[model samples]
Target chain A: MSDAATQPDSYPVTDRSRVKRLHERGRYDHAAVHAILDAAMVAHIAYVIDGQPFCTPTAFWREGTHLYWHGSAASRMLRAQKPGLPVCLTVTHLDSLVLARCGFNHSVDYRSAMCFGTAHIIEDLEAKARALDAMIDRFYPGRNAELRPSTAQEIKATMVVGMEIEEASAKIRSKGVGDEEEDYALPIYAARIPVTQVIGAPEPCPRLVDGVAFPEGLKGFTAGRRLDEVMVESHRTTFGVE
Target chain B: MSDAATQPDSYPVTDRSRVKRLHERGRYDHAAVHAILDAAMVAHIAYVIDGQPFCTPTAFWREGTHLYWHGSAASRMLRAQKPGLPVCLTVTHLDSLVLARCGFNHSVDYRSAMCFGTAHIIEDLEAKARALDAMIDRFYPGRNAELRPSTAQEIKATMVVGMEIEEASAKIRSKGVGDEEEDYALPIYAARIPVTQVIGAPEPCPRLVDGVAFPEGLKGFTAGRRLDEVMVESHRTTFGVE
Candidate 1:
């Protein structure tokens, strides 16, 4: 019942977006693409400068049909990406290690997405400010209003860029370990160790002032919930299923 | 103590490897670089083909003084990477989400490493086989002997590549949230939600034959341990701490 399974609009597969090697795992719908993008907190961004490819890991947020990331105004990554250069952003979540009966069949179950587009710098101050607020509110709901208003000087020192997601695709593998039929009969253990990101109890900053308590936004937080579950749930409650 | 803290030889700070922004967080010793690289299960690889940058996610392993990854012989990533091309391999672990009292100070605690080098395609059959075996044993120790040996065709259809760590650096941020002095009095929850990968109960495949019990290596595994702890512990025991 996930949106990715029922959404009607699908991304058109291009030569670059196509999953040639494992076509069976490729997904081309908004549900699949957005779910993967929204659940991931970090995206490895790839861009070329003078024929040398550089992959920089940075925090990213998705708004509407575009993806955005922010960095220092003087950063080379931001400056190079501001000119609408071609870029590829990838996010991956390792679900588990699949230990098969044989070494060849061993693999990791994972969910990953690749988004290709040209990034354009957000120039309007108002829009940039809103983007920054949205980024904060995405992680900690109602947090922007709780914090101090950003100064104009602070905004000027940050760079926010957006990409239209020209072509995107997602691939997922979440099944039990598959071993050769013949090897399954061997006296060996074949099982998958499920891996998930767990959020621990919140550790308050030592410099906090007295009488200030955990806000309403953090009351529902639990330590045992999966990272993606918390993220996807927050997105749904905030955005109303897009 | 971790090797990164005690190692004497450091990676030369090249123009490409230098961390300009937040240089205080940069670490060039083996302990820092290898610890991040070893703990991360996946690495985002960046390379250029016809001037276009492609970032692909693949599992990676580290051995001695080099990092290694393998894929199908026909995969574009493997094929393109075999000719000793300049590449950037980045491994990142999202440690936690830092909810600062202010929006500007909000950040994610993470450990990341970026390696710059030319990838040499592993051609020797014996070496490649040993590398493959090492990869399997790295993830699931003491299981290689129980599985069937890889055939010649299977060996020929896999491409293994190694990159000497010419220049690499690790960046880490693990402290509690830090917000501006004025914002500390705000009635907001300013804390860190520690994130760690949890290993869940082993799920046996449907094709698992009867009477096969779990191996000794897996019996001693616990679900609550951190991914890095398990990986580092395994590495320590398998090849006594360097």
Candidate 2:
């Protein structure tokens, strides 16, 4: 029921003005949303069970303004509430290491997004499977066709939660620290230590059917970190969400 | 009032088995705590406000097992909490990107810690400044001596919260995806995209007070993408926590 006109009533602060640095901020633009969501593979999810707070790390993928992250069948967050519960999901990517003349000035170059919304425990088998499929294809296209299908036990042991990306803002600082226009004269070291995601030479499994060589599926697969969790979760059972 | 023997009760969960891999887990010992506490500069701090979930990114430092992370004067978590309101603090470091043969096998190499406990607000100026210094000087040893000091007004405008890292377990996974013995022949690209954090050449500020170079205290300055916080914080207030 929410769209572009979304307000902050659903957030900790509705007056977006409180969010310091308004101009440099990336607002509700779709490009900004998709860019941060697509590049991020994991979301640090926070929610409460009873009066106690719980933060569960999970694998997630974004579709439009919604996020899908799932975990155990018996997870407290997945089972704490009846149909739904409030949750906060955040994703951050470290772009560079900013080494400064002073340790206090030491900082980082990063892109991050904080999204808040109520999560509905996705229960439908087909919807859950498709959600699971989107996660797999998020990093490896046509992956569903190439892998073994999940058995009933696996699905039963998994819990997939879907959240609408309503009330959200992305804050990012990419270049270097603010060395002030006139302060460059000090003899201090300052530079953005660029951190690039480069693919390393592949390490095949030791137990493969003897020198079978990698299949076409893994050809030049550089984006493996994005796929690892999806593979792990898809393999684990829906132990709590059921 | 707390010791390692019974500190486990302070966290949400005590059973070591619930956390999947508890022993080989990177934070299995005291040094692991120091290593993680030292390596990380910022933590994705999560706290509940007004019976809802909210997370604000903040700069944090660790002393022994207790964790310290704080925000601005108007932060919701600090002001919103009733006395002894339960809070969850979590800090994570994305170590590397793991690439596997299959798309679903992609994963991230990381070390993370989650602690559940009650948050107490610091209302005293003398104590708050010392706490802030503990948080700051941990990163920059001698800079607090060089900066201006904070006034009573600045101190009142900041909201600082402290938590004893009583009951907590750190989870870390640094390896690649575990493919089935027979799956390796199927052309899955399995390997790690090793992440390296290195300090780049330093850039001196140009506006130095004539001939004053980067201070001798600036050597061996180790900071990372994990630390974009406190930098902004130290700049905002004269409350130097060296």
Candidate 3:
């Protein structure tokens, strides 16, 4: 059985996180929600400041049911979000473009997660430092231990925020086009164009130390491999989860 | 001279749309903002409903200074956004991962645009139809002409919304890693791993009509090419601008 079936833990459906349209595509299970969040490198965080909504794109990682992100301490978005701000964090991966015989049936395949939570800054210095290292290790497992340690000033200037997901939903559309029955007989061509984010050739920094080889931790980032798949694999490697 | 320099039009810096941190990376010119928006297919739109913020990922297109997106008529988001709802629309493209010698300097090269405006449903049927066709042509120039025309019922089932760009800023970080001068002497390996979204081999639908050849309008979508580059080219072709 799949992990979701075995565990079967799910978030309770609240009015906010419920998928009203196309309800069949919505998943509230922990595995479904975590899988979508873990595969994405960036998340768009939405917060309201004085009645105006702002969506800021930031790098984020997931640990257990909590989502974490960091930014410069002086950032306006980060400063506003530090005081237990109600926010919605969303991550989306566009898998493919589905072309149909008619404009009405054209669609794109995607996996998306919308998580609602109250974000608060991580105030403890040691915990913040560990979270920072965990963020790096999530992308490149065990690489943080090899790098220069973060200076006190560096850690102080950064702000880490964590949000325990109160409610969440994962919506996925991974199928081929589903057109009206009679429309398939049309002479128009139909197909699915796959979309993928891939890693390109690595470019070494010009000032790299003489004879310093490529880091072993980043070996998972091979060229031509899908980035989301690699990120999921890296997350598994870091967290020791299947 | 570039188009932005010649035209010299820009969105007024509003309190909400202004880039507060690292202001040097912020751009207010039309060319800079439009280029980032046109190159992206999905936009995270932030909206507030009942004091809570929601960020939704939707396929979006740009025309002139306005942004457009459509969804099912029954979608809760569309229903809530139809009556001049305030929104922040953001598009982000992750270019590369910048691995510096220290965690403090770790960053991602990205191009992002955040636009602030009020969204309202396109109520007129004719205008909505034209906008829908324009959206299709934006991604696949001239493809709409080959497809079966949208029936009235289909048009009625879709909700198209447009938001005029009232305030906007584009932030871009495209350069190599900038480690601390003293840290460059460390023996740690540092490099940039480029990230790209690429097009893969097209998969033909099993029920395609016999002998229906590939459409000519989709020739720009070649395998192994960057999806954003192709999208930008397609936009230029459809809009007839450089």
Candidate 4:
């Protein structure tokens, strides 16, 4: 049921994707990279047009070694990227705020993945439609099947893009404050405040059709659940991975 | 005590920063752009190095029309950006998941600010030190002053960069699902699930000195409080702005 054993265990680290400064925190294993990517809902994609860099944040999902995202067919960013644009997609989960004894030591604990690849629009209609449904099911498993089928015009108005991960690295720092040994003795407070994205109560549309019940398959989105955890779980459930 | 009246009311909309797709959701006013930037902690800064774009997620703070972030002095990203690199800094808050009756209409409500500017390293020692402290105090208010002062070595090892906003725009979507008029009658579950980042209990460092109490000024970081709301409130309290 799983193709995990056949895949490469680690990404080939290139000069651009290598973690230079704090190399100890860098992980090139597919597990680390995939986990970070799967747990994140939004990724900031960086691409250059006319030597000017632009970072656009958009909802993205991962399937195997590929990442997918969509935008309006007419979006400037999407249009520019349709011709196989060199892009860097980055996902970061800010886990905690590390307040140290001094300003210099202040840092944030986060898990971040950066992937370098060329993104191209999915030109095939059948592939694009499947990718679109996969994205919806990625978050709300099984809900896509129950939703109203997409219209032909709707498919044409959306531009789905895919990027095969070329070189990727995950940088994670999850420990407590790392102040100097001397600074730890200073008469100052030091701690890590965990940061989390959580789901709140769902607000049903005021115009919901009668007898339409809340989608039970969206159990992963239950109120008060940590958003990242739920997303990782949903991805596992949908992909049939551990 | 506010300088609100003296500042420019809106950023000059540039060809690149203009929201071309959904023009109605675009905002150029200082209030809208600044509010979205202030409410978020992490900003993905994009810069091109040898024609390869990189999106780096970093903790950032906004003061007036300028933004600041810091990293290790020897970092590659910082080194490349020291020469006044053209960059885009984007901050996004995913507010809700809008599950509509069809895949085409499903979306995420978000408030995002994208700022185009040239980022340069802060060379002046005094200004860099002040900016570092300000970045710390931006989130924790008065906590920076109470913490142990930064050492000369610590200051030298850090690279602080600042960017004055050149062209900026805020794209916001806060409404519920916007499915087609006829699709609203479909027998499908549709709703907006609110998404929020919240703070958990602070975990004190195991090596903390005795009698050092949790900073009371961090009332904004109280457990269960929304992280974005607390950040905005902290910015207001620190900068004396509404």
Candidate 5:
């Protein structure tokens, strides 16, 4: 089920991890890689079967150098990603759209992390539950204590996979446009259109109990705060940012 | 460069396109598939090289069931994704985070589209230029005419690839959580935290010419409007929605 040519091994920037297009924007350190992963809510996971590639979007969590994702036990995608199988997990954030004086120069400011690794299914009940709890607490701090514990049947039906990042790189483009020298003299409206994810006011479930107040997790919440900031503050701990 | 096993064949939910985990959420029709593709700004493109999968996030535009993306001519990823090579492109939007009474029931509301297809390099200069114009106009309507035309050198340095979608499906989960029957009585704070991408005030370049007024595209713009709606409105005319 494995091919020597397909296996992923961690090296600096010489092999598949190298950034050829814009080498200046590439970062090969763990700090840069971890920061992007921690700030992202979802990852686009790609795996191959019978030479056909499939990219699926799912929520993921990171602890140390390992990333974890859980899904239904019967999922075909998850089942295909067993231990020693190659996988690529990618996370991206579109920071803004840059309109330049020349069409060729128009671009976007974005942060993206690409990780290559091998998957190992987490079958131990205790370890699985611990990872689940940590994931919940990471997204909604102190939330695990308030929620009902997972039933035996629920645990039995869930499957979690751990991927140790073997080789990873972060690519970022945060500056303004780079227009051609001749185009800067033209009469064009060039600017940066800032884009960010925002969290709106919490809407309680219709079946919520009559006196259930907003939980401590959402205190002082407003509609305009950046989604990245809200997620970072959810656990009051930093992950990938320096 | 093409293999029979790697060829993307169009079929309705019977073979590879079927959504096995949550079958009820899958849509096999072109209307659903096109709607999701039209609404997304970026796509996670996955392709296999030497049996290894690489998922790269890039801006994509869809026109008449064909998806197009352009990049530097020297891109290694693009070189490997030549005509007849299998590819998968996925687009996702995170609508909200659902907090359920049971941890197992917690999930996010999302809209995602998975497309399977074969890639073909757009070598015709006229078609390439037209696609590029449609892309720029789609993102910033009526702004292309005002900008300086792309130089021949710039066009020659860029490579455009088109992927004809052979099989595609859209999966959406829009409602609240699905808690177990026994967990409703718990005193947990369950709610939906709405997530949206916001486009803030445009910041003009400090070197912008004097008297360059705000373009007509952003008139009456509000901050709270959903990013999907804004992107759809950027290129007027609707698809799929009743």
Candidate 6:
């Protein structure tokens, strides 16, 4: 079976608790997990088809203990996820390139997290509606109540998948270049080139009508000050984020 | 069979022609994809494991024809990709989100790409060395040659997997908030809001040795003039920004 027919599942995350090297196997701790997840705006999900694997990425919202992922009802992933297949959900935020001393040693400084869990389909109309509202609320508040509810046909055409926290770990490397002790004295220059996400001046859509000022929600995207707040709030609901 | 038993030939990429969407999925035509992947520096890859699905994100590099991903020798993806497991790779970059006129109508504008391919393990010592070298060179031109070659023990312990693109597509959604046509003239402001990635002044590593000026490779990470180059380079690679 494939596509909407439902293919067999084939990917599993390594057991993090069994590993001794914390950096290699453990989640950085709660703060780090939240920080990394909050900093990210998207996620990549992977699954197998015919003994092969495929990864797909989409917008997501995290509220409390659950992560919500939604896409077209006809999406290959959506079809496969209907039974709540075991899925590996991962998120990464690249801080910068860690230019190390040696060829094999060259690495990047990044914040990434991986989790293993089974995603079950949310078939309830009320839950689906709430999930959609959560997504809307995260991207812009007041819109869920401000706008019309999803039509019955539209809801039926969309697919939403939900995954619990389950087993997960967040690992990070933020230091500068790492070279062997001997290479330290060499002519090499090693430093952490810091990188960050900064908001830019807003470019309103051309289709926006004249004389209408920016909404209070518009203040959210300014330099990402409110981004974390929004994301944290989004995670508060089962729908994840708007 | 597992990594210990499977040979490279066991994991052939099924149906290279299935990736026919490659041309239509070019990263440039889709502003959503361009913005998302450009803003995102990391991605997740998925594969099969004991009849389960798994996904993880590592640092990645994209040239014109290929997307390069590498990690430690013990990486599970490396072991799985050695046999050329059919894989779907995805990259997503998120810009300012759209808080549309309706709750269920809210959406995020993003840039994303997915490719189906078989990974051919670069097992030859020389080839493995070069692939690792090329990954390093992709970010820093002269640095790879500056480092020491991996010891035999290191090489043996390390696993390297390379995926050759067979088929791919880049999907995108950008501009502004998508709202119901009837609500367009209402008090609501519906339109696309732009988000940007800005490179700040390079903070040289504190350990950077004295007497050695910043390398030319670091030019792109520099403040001011170099920033534009970074964006242009990314655009060119993702969608031929020129």
Which regions in candidate 1 have their CA more than 4 angstroms from the true location?
A1-8, B1-8
For this target, which candidate reaches the highest lDDT against the unseen true structure?
3
User: Candidate 5 residues B106-181, lDDT tens each?
Assistant: 9999899999889888988888887788888877777777888887887888889998777788899998767777
User: Which one wins on TM-score?
Assistant: 3
TM-score of each: 0.94, 0.74, 0.97, 0.96, 0.92, 0.80
Candidate 6: list runs displaced more than 4 Å: A1-25, A28-32, A209-211, A223-242, B1-41, B62-67, B145-157, B224-242
Indicate whether candidate 3 or candidate 4 has the larger lDDT: 3
User: Which candidate wins on DockQ?
Assistant: 3
Poorest lDDT segment (10 consecutive residues) of candidate 3 chain A:
A1-10
lDDT of 4 by residue, A25-132 (tens): 998889999999999899999999999999999999988889999999999889999789999999999999999888887888999999999999998999989999
Q: Which of candidates 3 and 6 is the stronger one according to TM-score?
A: 3
Q: Where is model 2 chain A poorest over a 10-residue stretch in terms of lDDT?
A: A233-242
Q: What is the DockQ of each candidate?
A: 0.70, 0.27, 0.88, 0.82, 0.73, 0.44
Tens-digit lDDT track for model 5 on A76-145?
8888886557899999999888889888899999999999899888889999888888888878777788
Query: In order, how many clashes per candidate?
Result: 2, 48, 0, 0, 1, 36
Error of 1 at A217 (Å): 2.3
Please state the error at residue B25 of candidate 2 in Å. Answer: 5.2
| Residue-level lDDT tens digits of model 3 in B121-226 | 9999999999989988998889899889999999999999999998899999998788999999999988899999999888988999899988888998888989
Which wins on lDDT, candidate 1 or candidate 3? 3
Poorest lDDT segment (10 consecutive residues) of candidate 4 chain A? A1-10
Better of 1 and 2 by TM-score: 1
lDDT of 1 at A230: 78
How is the predicted docking of candidate 5 categorized under the CAPRI scheme? medium
